[model samples]
Target chain A: MSSQIFSPGLQQALDLVGIFVFALSGGLLAVRKNMDIFGICVLAEATALGGGVMRDLVIGATPVAAFSDLGYFSTPLAAGLVVFFLHPQVERINTAVQTLDAAGLGLFCVAGTIKAHDYGLGFVPSVALGMLTAAGGGVVRDLLALEPPALLRWDREIYAVPALVGSTVVAALIAGNRLTPLNAGAAALSAFAIRMLALRYGWRAPRAWHRNDSRTSEE
Target chain B: MSSQIFSPGLQQALDLVGIFVFALSGGLLAVRKNMDIFGICVLAEATALGGGVMRDLVIGATPVAAFSDLGYFSTPLAAGLVVFFLHPQVERINTAVQTLDAAGLGLFCVAGTIKAHDYGLGFVPSVALGMLTAAGGGVVRDLLALEPPALLRWDREIYAVPALVGSTVVAALIAGNRLTPLNAGAAALSAFAIRMLALRYGWRAPRAWHRNDSRTSEE
Candidate 1:
């Protein structure tokens, strides 16, 4: 039985590119947090692979692809090393990284959704896992850095929304028996475009209804 | 192919207890952070099952036991509800909760190690997964709360150490063909005692060689 939505070589190439960009974001965060070299590498690896690792585990893919593939392991370390030496230059090109991050988000969400479908997950949970696969690494990185998860923060530009949209699009195609490389590419690109637009526009999720509602309700 | 190390009945009970206590900790943190009811529930679930889910995914245990079991899904919600209503009283019993948390840590590490071994992970990674299983929930909790991971904080009591010791003990037994309920119980209890003692004594992990060393190294 065919186990993947895309050809193995194409998927591997997409996966590596996504891992590299996400790792850069993570490594930059570690630099901002003033962590040591080891900490930078840890954050990089976590950001690059944490979501995919999470998705694999939930779907029962044994040993995780990261654990099995030396490329998955080494890519993040390489990103971290680059960030360690040239964070100032990296910081100057922040827009480029955000755009790359958007592309990575697109690739991850579509890939995650397809993988979940292959594992027989239902629509809702599959979509959720797809977004998790796209966004979970940043959550892990932010947590390690003692910062609010950017995915959940209302102040941040819309992140998970694009991933969710891409996942939904793919899921809909799958349910309609129209899934194909062309459709998958369009779905991922849609997510990437939306995320890049959100970044460019400085879009934010709505905040709580009341500024103190969370605290007042408890009291 | 047997997938579990403990009897089904015993495992269910132990798992439930661990989930309940960990969920309580997560819920309390949410309340402290002034999160809404939904946030409390989210944190509770994350803290209770995050680690095991992570371990299961790594080992290719599909559907994660939590997703398959309604009880696992409901228990954490119940814990969150209780914390929501009785956070004041819950905070008053902080010491009791800490002790229970220690017990949960002990149970989780041993259980995680055995499960990893069952999944054919080598010794070192199995033990690491065991520690992750024991502490991953709290790390998730702290991250959700926008705080540093408790496990990584040098000022915090030595948390991973006890879990590591317990996992190592169990792994050693498994390797030596001496694993049994009695031996497992002893190993878990030994971990529990060590964690409890560390809590009571305010034990801390050693800080870096120099406070400015990390920053200086980068420059």
Candidate 2:
């Protein structure tokens, strides 16, 4: 399995970091919603592992990594505990959290595309799955929290675009027989840079054409 | 594949019916949310097929039944179209829709359990997957539409209970070596009856132990 992507140690370590950051986001959302501890844990787990589980399921990987790997399961619980005890402090470190989140998004998109490619998918579908693997967890968190999905909302920064870029970069690397760790790191970095730039500048997707007219004409 | 549970014809026909019904509910929700035709189709597909895909993934089934079968892929689009053109007339027949929804729930729970069991899972996990199969789509629909999931809310008349009952009934039938079509039908009928009665009597799950006090204390 490690040979399919990164070495075992490298893959596991990065995955754990990504899962931890995503779980923190979910736990914070639960706090804002005034949910109980159980809700907080559930939301954290969903946000941390939901996207990976979704990709595994789509690719027919049984017992998904979230369930089979103990670290993956426990990291979110630990994150939830941290949030429950020290949310105000956690809230103050927003910049740090966003930085970690961008890294996670970049890693997930590149890794997800490679995995899907390994599973015999074409490049186009692999790139699509890569975006899903990055953004899906946030979507799951918002859905469970009864909030609009940030990826689909106009107010949010361009989330999917960064993932798409990272995935496309991976796909190009694979096609060119240049999928070394160094190149992959650069691809991930590009994604991270794009996301940070989007966040810094308040970049957002445009709403549909004739948005108000569509609603009014129907009424 | 047919031998996994129902006869091929019976399975296909019943599955199509369930997919169509679930899609109708999803499409109606998208329409209510004032989504465009594309959104309506996406919601319909997710609501109809999301649960089964989740189950298939957990159970290690690849190319899932939804993607493998053309009928499964197209039925939701057809339902979305129906809702788009005839929602007012469909809305008028609330009782009919409710009855179909109950039937779909019943069918899904039983079939999902048997499929999981056939995949070599224990009864406990199979039953859980069964409930996931039946109720998971609606959960997806609500989550995507940004509504509080009805199954998890106390105000809703016990959605998961019916699915649990149906799956448990199937599990018991399997244990007793009486899992024929007739027995499975009876099991489904029991779930349908419970749901219809629950709707009539307004049964609800209890809230957490502390409830408002828990929140107030924290605040």
Instruction: Find the candidate with the highest TM-score and give its number.
Output: 1
> What TM-score, to 2 decimals, does candidate 1 have?
0.62
TM-score of chain B of each: 0.94, 0.94
lDDT of each: 0.85, 0.83
- Where model 2 places Cα greater than 4 Å from the true spot, the runs are A175-177, A213-219, B2-45, B58-60, B63-139, B148-219
Candidate 1, B46-68: lDDT as tens digits: 99998988887777778786655
Write down the C-alpha DockQ for each prediction. Answer: 0.16, 0.14
lDDT of 2 by residue, A53-140 (tens): 8888887766787899899999999999999999999999989999999999999998888887777666666776687788889988
Candidate 2 lDDT over residue span B1-219, tens digit each: 332456778878888888999998987777666565555666788899989988987787885766555678789989988887787676678788888888899889989999888888888998999999999999988888876778888778998999999999999888788888888888888888888888889999887776677454331
Q: Estimate each model's TM-score.
A: 0.62, 0.61
Off by over 4 Å in 1: A1-4, A211-219, B1-45, B51-60, B67-139, B146-219
**Model 1 chain B: worst 10 consecutive residues (lDDT sum):** B210-219
